[model samples]
Target: MELVVNSPLQNQIVGGEEIVSNTSRNFIEANTKQVTLEHLRKDCIIPVFAKDNESTISHYQFVQKTREIAQDLFPEFQVAEPDIRISHLIKGRIPSAIGKPAKELLEHEKTLYYERCAFVMEIPEVVENVNGNNLALTIGGVRAYNQENLFSKKSPEKFKVFIGFKNMVCTNLCISTDGLANQIKVTDVDQLSFAVEGLLQQYDREHHLGLMERMSRYLITEEQFAHFVGKLRMYQFMDKSEQKKLFPVSLNDGQINTVVKNYYSCPNFKRSDDGSINLWKLYNLFTEANKSSYIDNNFERSVNAYELTNNLVNSLQSGARNWFLHN
Candidate 1:
């Protein structure tokens, strides 16, 4: 199911104007690195199969224009390389000695231009969804930190856009740090956008909501409460002693007694002073143990119960904070 997205944002009027082109720039970056490693021995060769002068001129012009656009976008990266002589040849089928076909390459360049335009348009939305008003600050901080540390190797930056054709129904987004790639796959842009928006909203809601303080009142430490919550999640889904045996606590001198006392005091924990550990209690205990250590899953369920439990607690805490003031 799609998470959430701005429906009106899609199908908005887009100016049909050419913008910065990164096609050749991306292509060279992708190719050179691989070629340097000898992974791509000779420079990739693709044919230009145009029926007439107009068609052939159009294609060549597009390639040249795209190269110029790319240089403008990334002046540092686009430092002058020997101009690639695009061969003009006619054949029944296009020739591709190095990589994809000629037609494919042209289509790819067009895609790159459009993708950059789309990215510029959606920058606000992406920032709002990822880090809100603090997007620039976060990026700047990360960049500065990366720059300060000489030992830290930097990786090529990757950007992605989700495109949905035919309204919000069919959509996909392709992620590429592959500097060579001109065209990225967009399986369902609308759906992906919706999901991103939804996650952002969900995260926002959780952030506003504070912790389930009432439920956590009796817990000693955050870790203990986290464990308790983990067990609760496990018990809700897991079955019998088989699941029960999975979380054996490695007690130091009197850790079990300490856990028992903590659980007894907690409103959420379901254990009495009699030392009887209920299924709910067991779930939390097991979850905490697994999180503190490791437990192999029986494969009946997908996500780790402990991790989910912690996440749930965090969400709850965030929700609580949103609604109620914590002194």
Candidate 2:
């Protein structure tokens, strides 16, 4: 019997929902706050509830409950439903007998793990021996800005009451645009857990570290001195580590001069140590190159230097005994 081999395209084909991929593409450019609450409630989260066997409810279980309650309370807001045993729904697979350890389905899954603290309700509420210490109603806070004081004072926003679990306010309703993120006001806690959990999970999953990884590569393989300078300035100025992880590419001499001139024209650049040029700081004058632009000849010298350094490094990684063996 003869066997036929398939082409690379056919052999490597993988199946997945095209709609989900297209949907996630839009999600990539969106920030946490910009994402719609309805998407969080419907697509991302699940609902969870308290059970008779208190021992069965884990901390992660609590977070799931919070999400569901938040969704149920504000159904119109498009919150996620509460999910009990949401961890089980995460979709992971055990390693094959001859292969590696457990493998998660999604490489970039981010989840909120929560623990139960307490439950608060009116006289009709049921009391169960849960792990948490305190429970209270989720009341909206009035945080009005006082111009003279420059600080907002918090007063309870009446007409909204929900349960507090592990210092987290949860509700069985949806949040309108006006509702506070922390304070969930709903009639049913069970429904809120699903919505809240879903939104948070969706946000975490949509935002990956691709930009940071690309930037990191640029830092290690700097081709132009000008690019490094621009990158260094951006790196130093950024407050978040994730944003800084994006490495700047190599820049040419002309690009370096343009950046310098731009800085000189700015008021903030004059007073800052970054703007002033000294011989010691001259080495790092240039920063990243714009990949989309036409290639410049500045990288010729950098290429030669890089080749020499790479040869030495490659030799070291390959277990060359003597330092001068390939010199």
Error of 2 at 147 (Å): 40
Tens-digit lDDT string for candidate 1 (207-246): 2211211223222244445465455444445567655554
Query: 91, model 2: CA deviation in Å?
Result: 11
Q: Would you list the C-alpha lDDT of every candidate in the order shown?
A: 0.25, 0.27
Q: Estimate TM-scores for all models.
A: 0.19, 0.19
- Deviation in angstroms for 15 in model 2? 3.1
Instruction: Write down the lDDT that model 1 would get.
Output: 0.25
Candidate 2 lDDT over 48-120, as tens digits, reads 2323211222333333355345545545554322221111112222233223332332322322211111212
